[model samples]
Target chain A: MLERALSGSQRYWSWLIFLLVLMAIGFACYLYQFKVGLKVTGMSRDVSWGFYIAQFTYLVGVAASGVMVVLPYYFHNYKAFGRIAVLGEFLAIAAVTMCLLFIFVDLGYPKRIMNVVMHPTPNSILFWDMIVLNGYLILNILVGWNVLAAERKGVPYSKWVKTLAYISIPWAFSIHTVTAFLYAGLPGRHFWLTAIMAARFLASAFCSGPALLVLICLIVRKVSRFDPGKEQLRTLGVIITYAMIMNVFFFLLEVFTAFYSGIPGHKHSFIYLFSGLDGYGKLVPWMWTSVGFGILALILLIVPATRKKEDTLAVACAAVIISTWIDKGMGLVVGGFIPNPFEKVFEYWPTTPEILITIGVWATGFFILTILFKIAVSVKEEVAS
Target chain B: MGVSRRKFLKISGLSVLLGLGGKAAFELLAPGSIDAAMEPAPIGEGKRWAMVIDAKKCLEKQEKDGCKECIDICHRIHNVPNFGNPKEEIKWIWKETYEHTFPSRHNDYVSEDVHGKPFILLCNHCTNPPCVRVCPTKATWKRPDGVVMMDQHRCIGCRFCMAGCPYGSRSFNWGDSREAPKELNPDFPTNMEYPTRSKGVVEKCTFCAERLAKGQIPACVEACAKIKVNALHFGDLADEESEVRELLRHHYAIRRKPELGTEPNVFYLI
Candidate 1:
């Protein structure tokens, strides 16, 4: 099956090469960071976490969202998703890979990473996060590869594979929930101390993850002979619509609680993110841009006529991905650190090397995604023939 | 032919599980022996360390002359770097204003004397520290004496402890301390006895645990007493007659973010 990926059109090889160049640039920057310490990044004593952590948070959601397709197809016996279920699993493998890489690049002592395993402290949410994420990745690879291989051979996947798929459904939820606990369980980070954080994370993940899947399915349809099926894509659009609505609704619930309670601690982060607290509003415009895109995505996804059109659906999916990425990946982590524990605002922005290293990780993820998708699509095309 | 492969695997796996479980059961049954074997020896018998800062006396001294004797001595002895940039600054003990130190208690109409008074600040060494709770590697932990201790060598530098600490007490070595500008710190590691930390490790005041082990008080307390300010006091909280306990008994004192249930050992007398 991997041999299929080895032989591809010029476009495929070119794309891989392009990603390789970006990865090299990023690796170089990372080496520089490792030498000079985290000083090369934009983080400070006041804002200890920055871009790498934000990306890790958002990618965890994307990885968890694979359950959206897996659960409906596997548990509910929805036949429409059968065509694209493996695609969801493969996407999860790629996303989780990126999540782990982001964490690696962010560590100050990447060499000592095994200490998390060597001296595991059960009390730490990070300890659990390490367990769940690696577990989820392995589960996805096992289930996704075995199912696709069975499909290529025109046989039912074995019983063990089925059991693993069933286990993966709940494991998907655990990854994001553990990631949320990493933030929500911390004291004094009033912005992230919300009870609804896990719920909000799930809602955004459901929308954004499937939205990315929809766009990928469309691309797969354009470039390959095997279509993922019109009915499958349509059902995913409906899932995106409901999930985006829930994501927005959950955010407004946070807003209402903060303002209604009139607690400065509760309201300060929101104000800083939305309207600038004490004349520091670097993120205000970015927050509004996310809001605008969210509204745009909701309107496009809600209209059945537009959503039925592939072009309009593609636009809406792109909007949802961007909107959720900015909201979670940019705002959530940095906002919590503002007004540092001393009630003084110290803003964070990524430096050049930081941004490059981040890009390198993303490129590495896409490179893996391309090869995995190539193999899966080749199998599908073979089965169709 | 003697044993089927599946049967052999099952038997081997069962034996491994039993071996691990037996050791765990033994440890569970004899907890004290395992604890004694693993843990470092206790620092002092039945001692719970605490600190009391007399803010009123400190503010009077600061008002008369901008004195930072305590900060200078603690930083020097600890090999704390002077980065000269707040973003990269590292400190074991530092200063903050009264209003900023106690944000929840800030009143707009407070007296001019107390409103902006400089308050000496450091690790509260919380009785139930969130940093200890969130350290994935047990790199930062609380000793039995109520002092939150950091093991820099064991830290992976994930900075989760920084987020967990509500007081903002923990500081990561974002850059190498030894590479600090020569002008700011003319003689780096002024006290050769203390270790200069490498980059990418979190550090904070240990209540001068090394000095305490040598039967001396924390450097800040000694520095303040040397100047005749007598604003810093350190003693065993568990001892009713200790100086810290006596100060708390006679004066109204407050700890930062007491509502969070961290139960910080450091208290300030206003």
Candidate 2:
């Protein structure tokens, strides 16, 4: 099946080459960061976490979003998702790999990462997050591969594989929920102290994950003999639409609670993100841009006629992904840090090396995604022929 | 009903692995036992070690000419580098304006002396330290004696603790802490007994845990005592006769961000 990936057209090979080049450049930037400390990044004492952490946070959602498809298919016996379920699982595999990489790059002592495993602190949410993420990744791989393999052979999957698939449904939710807990439980960081944080994370993740899957399936349909089918796409579009609406609603709930309650500690973070608080509003523009994307996506997704069209739905999906990415990766982690516990805004802007290393990690994820998709699609094509 | 040797071995192996894992997790999760095992606190030492600051004296001295004797001594003894860049400033003890130090504690309609005066600030060493709580690697922990100790060697530099601290006391070594000038600054490592920190680790005032262990007062307290202002006080709150408790009893004192419920051990006599 992997050999089929090697025998692709000129365009596929070129795309793979392009990603490899980016990976090389990003790897070089990472080496530089390793030599010099985190000083290469935009992070300081005040804003301790920056791009690396935000990316990790966002990708966890993308990884956990695999559950949206798995849940409907396995539990509800939704036959439409059967054709493309493996791709969703593969997407999770790639996303979780990126999440792990992002955490690795962010660590001040990357070597001591083993200490997390060796001296596991279950009391720490971070320690639990590490366990769940790795577990989720392994679970997705096992279920996706076994099922895909069983399908290619034109046989029913083993009961063990079915059991693993069932376990993956809840495991997917755990990964993102634990990621949210990593932030929500913190004491001083008022921005992440809300109870709805996990809810918001799940809402956004469900939408964003399926939205990405829609785009990937569209690509798969266009490039390969494997058609993910129209029924599947329409159903996924609906999922994305509903999830995006819920995500936006969840966000506004946070806004309402913060301002209505009149807690200065809570209100200031939202103020800093939306309006300039104390003349420090670097993120104000980005936050508004995210809001614009979210609203635009809602308009496209909510309308009956527009949601029916694949091209328009693709555009809506792109909007959701962009908005959620900015909201989660850029705004959430950085906003939580700003108005540093002293109530003074310490702005963060990722440096050149930092940006390059981030790009490298994304490229690496895509590289894994490309290979996995190629294998899955190839296997499907093999069975079809 | 029919258990083959192969199945039996596989199940037993998995169970053994699971048992070991469960034990390991239980050990790590066991909060009290791990805390007790790690730092066998000095015998006969009363718990709840607290600090009290005489802010009125600090304000008067600072209002005349910035009296940073405590800050200077702590930096020297701890070897906290002067990075000069606010973006990368690594401070254990520093000065803050009265209002910034205490957000909801008061307003502009306060007394003229206390209103806009500078106040010395450091780690509150919270009794319920969120920094200790969120530490992914138990690299930082709250001792029974109330000092929140950070193991720099063990710290993965996640900066979770920095974010956890509400008082903005913690600092990360963005650049190498040992990069400070040995020749240019005569007092860089004023005390050879104190260990210099490396890059990429978070650090803050330990209430001079090493000095306390040596049966000497914290460098800042000793420095303040020498100046005769007696603004800084450190003692066990459990001891009824302790000076810190005595100061708190007489004066209208307050801790930073008290509403946050971190139960900051550091108190100020306003």
Q: What is the interface RMSD of each candidate, in Å?
A: 0.6, 1.2
Candidate 2 local lDDT, A1-385, one digit each (tens)? 5676687888889999999999999999988887778888999888889999999999999999999999999889898898988999999999999999999999887778787877778788899999899899999999998888899889988999888899999888898899999889887788999898999999999999999999999999999999999989999999999999999999999989888999888898889989978898989999999999999999999998899899999999999999999999889999998788777777999999999999999999999999999999999988999
Model 2 chain A worst lDDT run, 10 consecutive residues: A1-10
DockQ numbers for every candidate? 0.73, 0.58
TM-score of each: 0.94, 0.92
| Model 2 ranges off by over 4 Å | B1-45, B180-190
Residue A350 local lDDT, model 2: 94
RMSD in Å for all candidates: 5.2, 6.6
Model 1: CA > 4 A from native? B1-42
> True-contact fraction for model 2?
0.75
- lDDT by residue for model 2 (B1-270), tens: 799999999999999999989768868889467556666546234578889999988777776777899998888878877867788888889987787888776665888877767888999889899888888888899877888998998888888788778888898877666665456455665668777877778888998888777667788999998988889999999989889888888899988988778999999998
lDDT tens per residue, model 1, B1-270: 599999999999999999999879978898668667766554656788999999889999999998999999999899998999989989889889988899888988988878888889999999899999999999999887777888999999999999999998989999899999999989997989999998888999999988876778899999999999999999999999898999999999999999889899999998
